[model samples]
Every structure is written in structure tokens, then in C-alpha cells.
Target: MKRIWNNSWLQKGLRNSTFMQSKSPHQIDPELSDKLFSIVNDILPPDKQVKPRTGLLTFGDAPFHISQPNQHDTKAEFEHEYQIVTEAMAGLRKLVPLFLTREDADQQRTLDLLRLEFDAKMQQGAPETPIDVAIDLVRSVVADVGGLRASVRIFIDLFRALSERRDELEQQRDKFWNLPHRAPEYYARAIANRLAKLYARKTGQKPTSGASTDTGDASTKFTKALEQIFSLLDIQSGARPPADWAIKNLTEEDLAPRMSVLENLGLGPSPSRKGLSMSRCVLPEGPKD
Candidate 1:
């Protein structure tokens, strides 16, 4: 009897031969694979992480059925699948805050896992408090619920609080701002400013600065700087300020320089004394086209 080359046994033999020829070239390390699995495993729900029939060997849609027919390139396929898992993990990381706000058990589980991972990373020399954590919390929470405008407002509120606190502690700077944790605040401030710009682009309005009790020399300087920046933007665009553009309850003193991109938008202090307090911009009749 002649053996068929396309038979299962023959195909397995060919795959085995090919794999043996290059077994050491691109093998996935067991330790690294386990580490990647640990991260991926937490991103998915318990039931979805492992199939009943596969026990704990399967992860999401990627099965560890190494001996299955047509899965000839086992190592490459494994790595590719793991790469996809890592990408999913990255997305899940961003979505963790949303999940934490959810009431589902599966979501809470994923949130706890993410918090643990964040804590572990922090322990490894990363400053993970106040500026980093606080701003991120505001961003994820506000952006999830209130859209770009709300997110911008919440960021300004948080940034202003941090700035005020930092200013108060300036006399004790040797013990506070000098710490490594404060380093992240600088980056977070820059990110908040960028978010302010995004809000301006989305609404064609300057964001409320959320400056806490600014009625001093600092306030004057801030307002002047803000007006200068807004003037520059208007001049550079070669367009006059919108004829009908106007911000409510907000003067240059109440605006942040970074958020002065739109001088016509209106904003007011928060009524609730927490979060961002902002009033909607008043555009002239007939859509802001």
C-alpha cells in the first residue's frame, strides 16, 4: 500500500521535521511567555480566560492546541497570538477605569488586577501618586462619562488643586516638591494643557482655568500672560475674534494661559465646589458653523 503525502500522519511527520530543523531559532521563552500570559489573563474575564475543555491551557480565542493539524508553524503562531493578546492587554489597561466604575463582578475583577499591576510598577521606582494617579483618575472618569469638554474641565480642576497645594507647600519645598513623586506633576500639567487645547478645538472655546482664589499679583500676571497668548493666536491666524464669540462669567484673570486659545468662550466657577465648574459657551444663533 502506498502512503499518501497529504495524510495526517505524513503531514505531522513533515511538520515535525521542519520544526526540528529550526527549533532553536525562534522559540518563545517559557518565562517570558508566562509573564505575558499573566498580564493577558487578567484582562479577560475568568470564564473567557480559559475554556472548559482546554482547562487553563487556552487564553481567550488563542488555543494552545499545538498538535492540531494545519498548525504547522507552532512557534511563530504562538508568538503572533501572544502579540495579539498583549495588544488586547494594552486596550484593557486603558479601559480599566471604566470597568472599575461598572457594577459587574467580572469588571471589578479586572479592575483589581489592573490596580495590582499599577501598584507593582510603582514599587519599581515609578512615582505613582497625586499628579500621576489623580490626573489619570480625573481624565479616565470624566472622559468616560462627560466627553471632551467635561474631561477638560475636570483636568483643570485637578491641575488647579495640585498647583494650589504645591504653592502652599512651597515654603516646605525641601520636603515636598523636591521628592521624585512631584516629577510626574510637571508631565501631568503638560498633558492637562494639551487636553485644554483639545477642548478648545472641540468647542471653539477657551476652558475655564479653575484657578483657586486667584485675586493677587499672581493672578494679574496669569491674566496678562493669557491675554498675550490669546492675542498672539488671533494675530497668527489672521482672523479677528469671532463677532459673536463670547465666554460667560470668565475674564482673562479667570483663565489659564494654556487654555486661552479661545477668548470668546464663557465659563463660570463650579457651583458644587468640586470637579470643574463651567457654563456652556454662548454661540450666536444658527449653529457655530
Candidate 2:
């Protein structure tokens, strides 16, 4: 049992396969790991949990989808993300035998000292915890038990080589990313692109030129609207657009172009040709108080 259980492949995978300096904490200990494996083995169902689909459960779940149409829909999607996180954490809990920590140091110590007083209990074998009991076992894996740092370096290097191929493009991508964008026109174009993406995400289709956001109350309605707008405007946020965001450079024309640019890029929900022509389009609510 010990020979097969302490297989070399397991050691190589969990530590060297990833090329990290260390294995997951569970990788270090044998006895404690066995305990966790036993527990998780008991808890996991016969099959793995199936991923759900997009829109609804009919196609299986795609956890990243917005699914719904409003802010509340987005919030619901995030709540599902939380559920995924909690579920994964629960699985990790089952896979660990010693979940104790520095704060738990005293409790584990008490268990250790008590074992001394009642050595028979150690011989008899103790029960388990929901969190498992591996981490509190000991520090520093020895050469005999595959705890040597040299082995770790070998794995780390190999892992780095493998991952090096995977994310190599991700690294060099940033160099050419905005290289095409060096001038104010780049920012202008970017704002246009972002506006289209926003329109697509909200409506899931190309926006019409007639779909402009019409407000009845600027102070009340725009108070909430400005929070989203300033964030898009790349201005500092403090409950609302900063004084300088309003006074210094943020003019109606500056904001106006963004709307027209957005309509050109594709965020037009309004039918009017001047989709973002703010001066031509926006009329203040109720004569501004």
C-alpha cells in the first residue's frame, strides 16, 4: 500500500509537472495526504459535476455568460461564479487532511501533547475533520520522501518550459497591441471600439442609430448615469465626475464626439443620424431646475 501510494509519478506530476518550486501543500505529506484522499474519495460522487450550458440549463452551464438582460442579470451571473468558487473550495477541503494553520497551531499542539499523554490513541488512529488534517503535520520534506529542493528545481524548469510555449504569444502580444495606436486618434478609435462592445454586450446585437439614452432628469437621472459615464470617460471617480473632469478638459464637444464616434462604431440605439451629436440631440430635463 505504501509503495504504490507513494508512487514517483504522483510526485513528478504534482510538483515537477507544473514546474513550480513546490507541489500543492497536499503534495508534501504522505500520511496526511492519504487521509485526505480517503475522505475526498468517500465524498465525491461517482461522476464529476457537469458544467452547465449558456442561457439556461438545457445546454449545460457556461459559467461566464451574462445570461440575463439587465444589471440584476449580471449580478446573478456573478453569484453563479461565487457558487463555482465555493464548490471548488469544498473539493479542495476534501482533498486536504490537515487544514490547520498558525492560529490552529495551538489546537494541533494540544492534540500532539494529548497524544503523548495517551499514546494509545495515536496507535488506535484518530478520526477525521471536515477540513482534513494535512497541513499541520510537519515542515520540510526530506530527500528520502522526495522533499529535496533539487527535485523541485527540475520540475520548476520543466514546467516553465511547457508554460513558456503556451503564454509566449500572450507576452509579445502587448508589444504590437497598441503599437498601431500612438496618437490621440488611437484613443478616439479605441473609445469607438469600446462603445460598440458595450452596445453588443447590453443588447446582444448591433445597436440602432435611434437607440440613444434619453433622460428626463439630469441631476437625478444623470447622477447615476454619470458614475458609469465618468468611468468610461477615463476620469477619476469620487461619487461623481471630478470638478476638473467637468471643468478642465471634459467639454460637451469632447463628450459629443464620443457619442458620434460610438454610433459610427455601432452603439446607435437611436435612429437619428446625429446619434452622438450631443448638442444636436441632448435637451436638458425640465429646464434645469
Candidate 3:
């Protein structure tokens, strides 16, 4: 009797890891997992309470993924994840009754039955889910007379049903993923490219038009033009533009094209213009009375 109980415990442990790992803490039905945990915790001995630490179960690892948990931000988070593991174990215990009905099947018999059913499901490409297997066992019991034969037949049928359902879901998932994207996404990308081009044009250095020029002559001409405009406005200014304001290392040939670009942008030396007249001030008259 003791041996049979241990075998049942092993079966539950094996199922616990597989089932809990696939499900997230949110999926752990609050009422169901809590109820299950209460029952299993009461039934099992303290040492027998399986707390899978590493990547073996869902809770200790990432909450909603299959990856390993490298670190936890706080001790509370770490404790919470393990708590989920305990809850999952309870959830798994809820399925045992669907299979083990009679008191006759001893340890070896029960183990063999579960192992065979698990292998049968794997052979048919159904995922190893203990809850699913237990559900299948219930159906198998109903289909045939309750015994070993019925268990075997039920497992085979269960595997086939799971495989068909998995295939159908995969087809639907593929269809949804392959659908065309929205038009606005493409339009947004195009607008972004155009804006980038405008920014580049505004900031990029424009190449000088001609390759060579007499630097001394061009410099003399530009200085004359600059001073002529200054004199016409009667404003005394520095002979050269500030180094910080424009290209300091510009060759005379390069300066000409850049100056032309500035001129086109309405920044070139303004046409030599006479200063405009200021408005004359008028005095207000006091009241005659």
C-alpha cells in the first residue's frame, strides 16, 4: 500500500513539471490551483512537497515564457514565483482521481499505466500534459469497461484527437500571421524618408562649383564687394566675416560657390542701399484756456 502511494506521487511529480512550465501564473486558475494546493499539501508529507527550483517548472523561471530565470529584482518576487510552483503542484493533484479508481492496482501497475499512456501520446505528437492525459483517462474509462484494456485504447484515441487539434490550430495561426500589413505603416515610413532627405540637404556641405580659381584675385574682389556695401550703409565693420560664423579653411574657389548659395538664400551683401530717414518727433500743444 505504501509502495502504491509513492508510485502515484512520482507520476504526479513528472506531470507537475510539464504542466506548470507551459502555463503562466495568470493562467493558474486562482480558485482551482488554490483548492488543489490545499488538498495536495494536506495529503503529502513535508519532504514530498515538490518545489522545482531551476528551469524545471513555470513559476521559478520567467512568469510567461520558457526561458531560465537568471535573476530576480527582489526576494518577494523570488518567493512569489516559487509560490506559483506550489500552486501548480496542487493543480496537478486534481487530475489523479480521473485515472486511479480501484484500490487493486499496486505501485508497478500504476507506474506502467502512466508511462505507457505518456509514450503513446508522444508517439502521436501530442504535447506531454498530465491534465490532458488525466482527462483522456476519464474518456477512456467511459468508452470501454473499466480496466487495463480500456486505459490503453483510451490513450491511443486521445493521442490522435490531440494531434488533429494541434494541426488545425497551427493552420489557423499561420493564416493569421501571413495576412497583409496596413497601408498607413508603409506611408509613415515613406514620409520619414522624405523628412530625413530634407534635413540632410539643409545641413550637408555643398561642393564648390569650379575646380580652380586665382585665390588672391577672388579674395580681393569679395573684400571690395563687402567693403563697398558697408561704406554705402556708412557702417564701419570688420574686414573679414567671423571665423566662427563661416568655413575658416575655405579655398577662394570654394568660397565663391558658397557665397552664391548664401546669395540665393537672400543672405548675400545687400545691394548698396542708402539709410532710410527716421520719423521726426512733433511736440504736443498745451490747452488754450
List lDDT for all candidates, in order.
0.34, 0.32, 0.34
Per-residue lDDT over 202-263 for candidate 3, one digit per residue giving the tens place of the 0 to 100 score: 33432111111544221432233323333332334432332112233333443232232212
| Model 1 steric clash pairs | 246-264, 247-264, 247-265, 247-266, 248-266, 270-277
Model 2, TM vs. native: 0.18
**TM-score for all models, in order of appearance:** 0.18, 0.18, 0.19
Cα RMSD for candidates in order: 25.9, 26.5, 37.1
Candidate 3's C-alpha runs over 4 A off are 7-147, 180-289
Which pairs of residues collide in candidate 3?
Answer: none
Among the numbered candidates, top TM-score falls to 3
Tell me the lDDT of model 2 at 249. Answer: 34
Q: Can you write out model 1's per-residue Cα lDDT over 229-249, one digit (the tens) per residue? A: 334223222111211122232
Give the true-structure RMSD of model 2: 26.5
Clashes, model 2: 21
